[model samples]
Target: MNYTELKARHRSERENYASNALSLRLHRALSWLNKAEQVEDDDSKFIFLWIAFNSAYAQESGQKHYDTERERYIAFIERLVSLDSEKKLYNLVWSQYSSNIRSILNNQFILADYWRFQSGDIKENAWIEAKNKAMKAAHTALAHNDTTTVLSIILSRLYVLRNQIMHGGATYGSGANRQQLADCSALMFDIVPLFIELMMAGQHQVWGDAAYPLIEH
Candidate 1:
């Protein structure tokens, strides 16, 4: 196909996928979580919570390189921060979920041995320490294919938490697991938007430079 035709196709596909699939799924997941919170039955709440968590996990970490590619995802995150540094939406998300992210980092039960290994006796900011450990784990995983190290990363934390709950590691009424689920839901709500924005930016960079630009909206 010609460049013009190819670009148009790309735009059409991206718009359809974003609107039809990504946005729809995200909306449904969030809606489910909202409804789930209202229920008094712990089993029902846990089931719906797991649905939301799995939805976010699939979108965020289902990519091929997400688990294996250290530098690529790190660079993507860095670029996202740089691009949206002054944007109010980004700042708002950060303000709301920054503590939630830290909580995920500090959760020993969810992280298990990975937590014991990385947290150590250091007394640093939880968020900073978590970020460092995740990055280091990513690097190690990419280099050595270490499952434990890979599981220590942020994406892995999200995935593992979902797995643990979905696979019966934690009971429905468990206070600790429920808190972790809530935190994951909040973190996903913030981080998913950033991931979508980064993806759009990457596509724009590619097609824009080729003289067939993507629509910003």
Candidate 2:
């Protein structure tokens, strides 16, 4: 389910759909996914993939106060898992990428609490406790085939990587983060396409309106 194949499928089927919001989201997400496939740099590839993921999941709150970005995407994951009747996502997690997923979970640099502790905003024990707690929860979720929970935790770590790159927190082409970048990009390369395909398959279900939709003059 690469971009080319997914686009062909969308063109063949999308005409019957009524929601412009989903159409727009798939368009944006697929375009970035196409760009990601062409780029050679790990940082560029990961950032582009994150944008694609964001395009697929992001939505407007339609109110002044909105859910946090974490909440918004976690909710999206819940919807995705519910719609995944064949367990494609769960099998992808458990069968194909379990080791890669475990490595990402254990990387403290990608944990928000680890950074807080590093900055002295939190004590060492607090962040360590938080890290252990998160790992235990993820391990339990994986054992139970909890697709939504495991996917949510994986994306949380990826979001930390996204922030580091998007916010100038990482040195360009730095050797230190290269492995993490490569692993994250590899995971996303498979996952984002499935996400787009899943959304296309479940278009009748309510996916809230995409944020910042297009407007004609």
Candidate 3:
């Protein structure tokens, strides 16, 4: 959506929004997340970005943000109901922490075989397990079945790339590996923005003009 133009438009408003201590943190965080998205290669970064964005959103609005955000997603509905620990909305705060969940899972899956292979103990099954769990958690948290295939494939591809980075080579063969790498890059760059919309209640996109998917659930 012409991020440069939009950022220029909101620069003054954001600067004014930053005058308050909370908004100030949010302003800094929005900038940080923007930068993180540009170079983020791991789940840790996504986790950090999600936390920063979610906190900023919470501070910017209120508990209602959680509800509205949950309503936008298919799976988070039940989780949201169970997350209102502060009794903010309806005693459901789990959904409130969904972003954090995604970040952790993303990181874990990405490191799958690499962590073990680096330790000189490459258990293919273990790697598969980690990748599987992360995919299930991520897709489940997203609560959208349509994306299950793409997200799983993309996440696995990214994990494999990290695996290669850690091992300095490829055991999954070159052609397949390169294809997966390209797919992973596409998935990360393309899907992450839609993900942000689903995760943050009021956060705006910084990269594109894509419309949110029409979710019925």
Question: For this target, which candidate reaches the highest lDDT against the unseen true structure?
Answer: 2
> Positional deviation of 178 in candidate 3, in angstroms?
2.9
Residue 95 CA error for candidate 1 (Å)? 2.3
Misplaced by over 4 Å in model 1 are 1-98, 114-153, 205-217
> How well is each residue in 1-217 modelled by candidate 3, as lDDT tens digits?
1224334544545543313443344344456456655654443344444443343333323323445442322233233323323333221113422543244345543464646765779766777676677557656644543333333433444544554554565543345344444334433433333332232222332221212212358
lDDT of candidates 1 onward, in order: 0.50, 0.87, 0.41
Which portions of model 3 show Cα errors greater than 4 Å?
Answer: 19-111, 144-177, 191-217
Judged by whole-model lDDT over C-alpha atoms, candidate 1 comes out at: 0.50
- Write candidate 2's Cα lDDT for 46-72 as tens digits: 999999999998876683344588988
Model 1, residue 169: C-alpha shift (Å): 2.2
Show the lowest summed lDDT stretch of 10 residues, model 2.
59-68
> Best candidate per TM-score, number?
2
Model 2, backbone clash pairs (residues 3+ apart or across chains), number: 0
Which pairs of residues collide in candidate 3? Answer: 1-208, 1-209, 82-92, 83-92, 83-93, 83-94, 84-91, 84-92, 84-93
TM-score of 2: 0.94
